[model samples]
Target chain A: MKKKFNLPVRQLATVGAFALFLLLGNFLMAKKIIGLYYTKVLMVAAINMILAVSLNIATGFLGQLPLGSAGFMAVGAYTSAIIMRKVTFVSPALAFPVCIIIGGLAAALCGFIIGLPALRLKGDYIAIITLGFAEIIRIVILNIDSALGITLTYGASNLKNIPKTTTFTNAFIWVFIVCYLVSALMKSRHGRAILSIRDNEIAAESCGINLTYYKTMAFIVYAFFTGIGGALYAGYLGILNPSGFSFAKSIDILVMVVLGGMGSMTGSVISAAVLTIVPEILHAFSDYRMIVYSLLLIVVMIFRPAGLMGNKEFSMDMLTGLFKKKAKGERSKK
Target chain B: MSTFSLIIKQIINGLQLGSIFALVAVGYSMVYGIIRLLNFAHCDIIMVGAYIAWFFMTNFANMPIIAVVASILGCTLLGVTIEKVAYKPLRSSPRISLLITAIGISYLLENTAQLVLGAAAKKVPGFFTAETIRIGQVTVSTASLVTIAVLAVSMVLLTLLVQKTKLGRAMRAVSEDAETAQLMGTNINGTISFTFAVGSALAGIGSVLYCCAYPQVSPTMGSMLGLKAFVAAVLGGIGSIPGAMIGGFMIGLTEVFVSAIGLSTWKDAVVFLILIIILLVKPSGILGKTVSEKV
Candidate 1:
């Protein structure tokens, strides 16, 4: 079966096809065949992909539920937004990466701090604590805006005039970087350790995998990318409101991850893209769109419990394994 | 107001708010205890109940008693349907899958309410006229008295139901061990559906009371309150009813006191602060017993 199918060649072809599709998309956007509005939607999809994939690392791969993605995203968004707003000397080119990094680092710091204590609490308890942390961060931001009187957050004022730095090129570039980085991480030894911990914390711990250290690391890394995604989101949308990063928004991201197969990076990417673009496509049904989305989620849970792609990767081995088992069954029948 | 009066006011307000939290928390704790699933839609049940009450108050202003009874029944039915449709099928699925479904059901309920009812906040007519009773230098509103009375009655009824009734015994048996209970001739589905119905009915009562005290109801109102109630449930111990009440009171008092200290905006932070502090000190919660997870 292994010799009958060349897995590497099929893998390369799949990558090439995706690359070509991305190039064509870039070309279409550049040539204005697709309007800027749609291009902007694609940009949002890229950001969502980053968030969904990063969060999937924690929620999907690690089997740990963390509901504080929005809180961490707000940290990244505000940190980046504040720096970009306040700093005058830096050029947008240098400022962009710096702000994104700072945003990610800030989120990572929060993640590490929260994760240290929270990693000890599993399942629903961890979920609630993380949710509390998110709410606290949001309320703190609101209070800071009110108390300082400096208009730091502009107090219900939409954070405006964020130098728009996220074009399709940059958005796609960052998306690719994040997707590849996380995918590779998931395939690495550290990824194995994270997955192991999710499978059984006790056994993982017994195997000398420090539950605290690895779990915290996965959380920080997840936060870092989510932060970067948030930074991009702030810049792309050109406005940041405290309400925009509410728990509902966090749930939206979670929906994307869950709708996409949890443990599958490709599933996250596809689900994020579909979820982001679908609402726009159903613009006429705006009021009922969310209702439909929610119902769709319920149906998915009831019927397709494994999600859209399950845990399978986009690989030839999976394809050939099907035929190989079929051939064996045929021989046995004969 | 004098300092002592102010202190008394805060305490009363805290108790009033805490009672509401306690009511909602019971729903959360009971559901969690029985199914080990955090019914995110439980909060929306509160919203649905409030809407039902609002429907009654608006269209049937002259029939308050009938309206309240109908609303409770409506919410009870909604809760039962939610369990049968949304949760039962996914019982054997992974915990996260159930969580996602709960969240989806929550969103579905909220959005459905928004679609059917407009996004604007609806006014729930005051159940009773404003009248304050004075005890020496301290005063409490008639509404506060009603809230306290309602909560007390509900608690007594719930305790009686859980302790004295055959259905309650069956519920307890199922919660302790579902498979074994089935062997003992208890209807697992009926008990769970009944539990959801009762829990949601309590949430409905809570919603009506909460709306009366606050006097405004919105479609999105349930999300925050729902989260707070979940926190209360956890703080008191996930499956313990009395613990939920205590947790709710603790949270309510903490919020009221924090606000009184001129940190009104930080009230949310304070709630979480208490949760974190409590969780760190007693990971099992204030009134919760530790259950060992099988390896």
Candidate 2:
């Protein structure tokens, strides 16, 4: 009778709310109700959200453990930063997006190269190989200038003078785009192929999914957006150095992905926000914070290994279902 | 020094480093073989061992024998306790959880050590006396000689223990199939605990040797060393004992050579590059078995 108050309208409503929230956040910043400190935290949370979600595609969906998110991020950051520095004629507005894309592409190229050979190995080996690659990437960035006799990358020293272009509005926008693409990817036929591979590699291969192709594809997508996140990270900080993208940095991102439920985009968003802010809130226990945080990780895995959200996503329907108690019936869909 | 002599010295240097890597890597390989975990805490155990040694050496003022025994025993106990407390419950869970838990434990050890010991490195002088034995064209430190000798003795003892003992057989059975081993009345828990003990003991020995070479103990020292040793484990073929040893030597020599060529800064990169290349060429590692997944 009411034309079935359907999917498209619900999608439109969610989209509108998302935009409205963004506008509210910007307005609050403008009004100084969200201070500079809080705004910085929000920006960092946005960056980490991009990192965790993009990492989930490769780690969560592809079921591969790669310790090289920071490597790709470093590549993207340096690539875009260097290019931005090189191009003097263009306006900041025009050059920023192009550089971000180029940075992403460069990182994707690295992922493809590393993943092609690395995906051949099984679980722990892939993790080790990726860690090696990340370390090598950092060292290369650290020494590329002095070894090759070029002024690029500036070696171990920090690369400075890049314009800061990552505003809160733009970074959160990128986060939404990355989350959308990743989720859409999971729902696509190809995403099915990727997930199936993760669920059981041999079964998928027997069913005729080219194991290498799908694996590398997911990894490339991961590296590409991680690169973009890194690019934004680059613009956010306006400086770059190999020291900034160490193995520990990659571990930090992994901690976020693992702390949030792997394979859950909404979980990544929540954990990223919570993790970024809570550390600041507990600033008094800065030294002991890692100890507590690590203990929390152990407890979470022991009691609930599925992480804070498990594999469940935070859907709009779930929110409505909480109010109406019909989400389960709706989710069954039969 | 002549070119030949310099090369000889570098070879000695490589072997010294290689011996330490092999010592550390044995722990990683053994743990991975039995438990199928990366055991990020294995490296941190070595760090704890170093600190214990530092504690003994600094507080007791030069009781090297007491320091060595206490450090090794401390690492062994810590390793077994970590397995009991942190990893036992997750034995049946997904491997990723175990891995994250291991990492969490590693962070716990490091941060605790940092908070307690302070982040700055406490320099502990070399355990070996500064005795240089010069042969026809080469001069060798007694520490290097002792390192290689200890590695050799440990490897022999380990191989013997794994090959000729009941516990070793139980370890092999559990690694092959835990359910089958338990069905056959193997004490799976005891065997796993024993494995952790042995591995941590190796880490303890490694830390002692490392303290000799580097003469310093810091909270973060073990992270990179542990990573390199794990790579060594992978390079030789994960889950293979001799593979770990060979991988360690290769990595050790690679680092020495890279540094020798005036690319000291790039040595870490070179070690990782060698690992990547080796894995690309031989996916299972030099001595690793190629396991095919059964559908």
Candidate 3:
């Protein structure tokens, strides 16, 4: 008898691919093959991937249309930025991780509070409330200092000069970890329950799934990672403005999810990369970029509502299936 | 101004703003009632309407009435076309897809405006003379009077159209149940197009009023305005016409009062905070029907 390698192929591939990506990134950076502009694009794509994947939990898995991903990001960005700014005694490496946690927790708390009352409503109502919440968040950030007599948030003006802690390596690592955790969570029993709710709410309820509990849980998870992405974004920019996290920003992330396939994590990653990079490559169309992007959204939604992937997960089985078909073809030729 | 006059003036201001919001909210609630869409682009239609009015008044005809009518007609055509093109194809798709399309359409309109007219805010030429009418210590601008008058007339005419006419019945039937309405020989497509036209017309009227008061038009103006009007629709209980009117008024009042209390910067926040509280306390809204999902 021969012993065989039976370790999870998907997990192994993910680790291998991520390691390879990091190595390639380092090589490119070291050799100056990757310029500042390209590196910035890659980092932004990583942040968007994190956003799209986390939003998939709520919009894709849980079947909720929350148009407030940017609000959570804003909370994370501001909280983490404030922490990094105020906590000058800590090392950048130590402070960076702590700020991510703090920012994520703050956004999670906001999600819990918002979802408590909001998730009760059905359909478009939730979208409206979430949008309003995002705007309200912006407005509060704009006027909070004046209202509270505190100098925090700086009141609508851009909060500038924070440490730049988000390197390509760490961003890639964070995105990898988030994607791994999200995929794992989606594979668990809890993920199935959430998927059931998305498929059929009444039937899901009859099966004894706690609708409110699961809904809020998914939302909080979505907010938590959105916050982390925002924290990463803040560090990447070293300055923050509430305007950057406007309703348009939320729509930007939503477009990626919708274009990628709401329920497919791999779809989100692909679309996020394509959408982010395509715009940069076509710099001449910068003015028409939004127009074209929006036109694509309407066309895609009209033609392929399930998105480019249509709820299909990318798996190692796909690769093996292709190989097996090729092998059979070779055998027939022989 | 004395505190009493100042308070009175703010009330007038609130009413003027509320009427415009109510007009926009009416379109929002009507479209939602018929198609079950939030119609994110509805407010952008208002932006288009404003620009059309600006173009007509500045370039074609300087007459305010011509500008107003042209704007309304332009929006009606644009709204109907958008429905036919972007939304109609996705009619059978999931609600989320339609919502995303609406957002896309909104982005398209905003970007087009940005590309064509530039992102800088354009000062809209005054459509009416600024005349002040005094009632005791409180003075009200003619714009406020005209806005209230327009809102009143539109509301009455809309109520009559919705309650008494054959097309209105068809609209009601489609909104209630499209399949059943189609089964009963209602022109579902026509009614939907009509709904869009009426809603867009109202948005056009709202835009004129908004420009009268604010006097500035920009590509991004519709977003905040649309969001607030949607809040008004939600607050009034979506799918209910009269509810939208009350919701709009409440939002306007809240915004004005917030500013009156020297929290002008927080006015937008206050409006949203009120919406959240209303949702938490009564998610169905002040005038919206409580929908019971059948298990």
Tens-place lDDT digits, model 2, residues B71-165: 99999999999999999999898787788798889988998999998999999866766667898989988878888899989999999999899
lDDT of all predictions: 0.86, 0.88, 0.89
* lDDT for position A294 in model 3: 93
CAPRI rating of model 1: medium
Poorest stretch of ten by lDDT in candidate 2 chain B: B124-133
Report the Cα RMSD per candidate: 3.0, 2.8, 2.1
Q: Write one digit per residue (lDDT tens) for candidate 3, span A28-51.
A: 988999998899999999999999
lDDT of 3 by residue, B73-149 (tens): 98899999999999998888888889989999999999999999999988778776557888787889989989989
Q: What are the per-residue Cα lDDT tens digits for candidate 2 across A125-208?
A: 778778888888898999888989999999767999998888888888888888888888888999999989988888999999
Q: Please report the TM-score between candidate 2 and the true structure.
A: 0.96
Clashing pairs in 3: B237-B288
- Candidate 2 chain A has its poorest 10 consecutive residues by lDDT at A1-10
Q: Write the per-residue lDDT of candidate 1 for residues B1-295, one digit (tens) a residue.
A: 7998989888889888999999999999999989888888999988988888888888888777766787788889999998989899988888888888888999999999998898999998777755688888988887777887898899999989998999999889988889999999999999999899889899988988787778888899998898888889888988888898899888889989988889888888888887788777787788999988766
Report candidate 3's fraction of native contacts.
0.85
- Stretches > 4 Å off in candidate 3: A1-9, A329-334, B60-62
Which pairs of residues collide in model 1? Answer: none
DockQ of each: 0.70, 0.77, 0.78
